[model samples]
Target chain A: MDRNEPLDRVKNRRDSALRALVSGVPYMTWLGVQFDRRGDELTAVLPFDQKLIGNPVLPAIHGGVTAAFLEMTAIVELSWSTMWEDLESGRISPDADVPDSLPRLPKTIDFTIDYLLSGLPRDVYARGRVVRSGRRYASVHVEAWQDNRSKLIAQATAHFLMPRG
Target chain B: MMVGADDAGRDEQARIAQQFIGAIPHARALGMQVEDIGAGKATISMPWAPHLVGDPRRNVIHGGVVSALMDTCCGAAVMAHPERPRSTATIDLRIDYMRAANPGQGITARAECYHITRSVAFLRAVAMDEDGEGPVASATGTFTVER
Candidate 1:
């Protein structure tokens, strides 16, 4: 963020950064997590996969995987907020000096989840809100929903030890 | 661990635990195995695999994998409860991760459904790595009991 780039370049850089962020985590790729990005915001998507179901009888996505999706969203969103600020401040330039690899994400301290309803056999989406983010700590709340946003499949709150900038 | 008075009852619970793991597609994907089970308790383990890694450079498995294992094990414990339990669903789970699981060490989780009411069961679980001296994560969860 040392200097402002063209708006188009900023958009492309943000998209690439998010993609790189997802690709950086092998488990996220294994879960087939994708992101729909708008500027600095992100909504994580977990595509339908039979391998994700924990209950064959109910044909529902595993509760653990739902938790994973929420955790991943919280993580990426948390990391992105700081990185985005760095990008805007021109502290690092992806075009010239930023390393090919992204910085390490914050370490998770604790995660608590509440399952509202069984996740149906369909695509699921999650959005993370950064309840608080500081130089050394962050707290995030994430919720996953299917067709009806009002009806959440699950929601989670996590506290992470943010990596020092 | 609560051991059933009769060996036959113990074996039957073990068989049910195995069948339970086999029935879940996600459990299969994780290569989960039934280690032990009895009335109101269950133990499950899963081996480490590349696909389960959260941080490849660090060789750390994903937290979600452990969460899933604990969740499944908790439900299994509820299913094996002495009461008229038929099926179960996770209502809420709180997991305090002490540390990341070792890279190549398999993880084992043991859960005990200590109490059950008309429609709810309470369980506590611990996840340990073969290489660790202490638990990798400890969890307490509430689940719905469907009799």
Candidate 2:
């Protein structure tokens, strides 16, 4: 019924799945990832440190870091949101929850990114929003912003393949 | 103080550069070599691979590989800096495909950090082949520097 209960259940039951999600990304570990979720939107922030500098004057960030951050956000969003049955099965009957018929996994089919503004030093944040969680697929719009809210560093749209009956 | 262009400095740089490029297996498989590396700048190159095809039918290399290459080289540039060794995470990256890479053409990436503050790091990289007039793809990214 409570949020912590589900997280605990996942931790106890799906350890391998969770570990795979995190361990698969060796580079993500290199960048020190911090994860968070609010409602349906999932976010991850990587704090800026000295080792990330490519040029002293320009100080470029790594593209791998961005790709990994987006992927991680997607993974968390998919894993945390349980379909209706999942919550009901766990003994939590909340009418607000979506139906149980919807599949849990979202297979990433394709993604496109556009670089609007250059990212500068400070905290880098990625917010992933579910565009459409359909029967066969799920799409998301992820926006990454840096220190300045007005300047968007990168934006990505990802399509995932959802399991179907 | 200005460091002279001595063999010692050059060799040290080469060693450090090798360490950065070694992180990516594909880059190693492609025989990537670092042309130069300084406090915050790096240039890495890998010869074109026929096997790096993206679409087998069209013989186009997958955009994923290009993205990976861009990420790897850009990360190397970031790690080459002689500052704190805090981990760096990629917050976001965008790659624009200027043109498809020529089949059998070697590829090279030049990446640099435009600006870095206490929390965020900014990066840009250009990938090109021998022709050099135009880039195959250009990337810009943000990274969070871990303390």
For residues A25-51, write the lDDT of model 2, one tens digit per residue: 334454566665443344678788655
> Which regions in candidate 1 have their CA more than 4 angstroms from the true location?
A1-4, A93-100, B1-8
Task: Mark the regions of model 2 whose C-alpha exceeds 4 Å error after superposition.
Answer: A1-155, A158-165, B1-11, B23-26, B82-84
Q: Write the per-residue lDDT of candidate 2 for residues B1-147, one digit (tens) a residue.
A: 111123437557757667545544334654678887666567778766554543333344445456666776666666655554356656666666676677557778888877777877788999887788788888887766665
lDDT of 1 by residue, A1-165 (tens): 535568887777777777777787778899999999987778999999999998787789999999888989999988888788776665654431243557777888899999999999899999999999888888999999999999999999999998775
What is the TM-score of candidate 2? 0.47
Best by lDDT: 1
Candidate DockQ scores, in order: 0.84, 0.10
RMSD to truth, every model: 3.0, 11.3
The local distance difference test score of model 2 is 0.60
Evaluate model 1: give its lDDT: 0.85
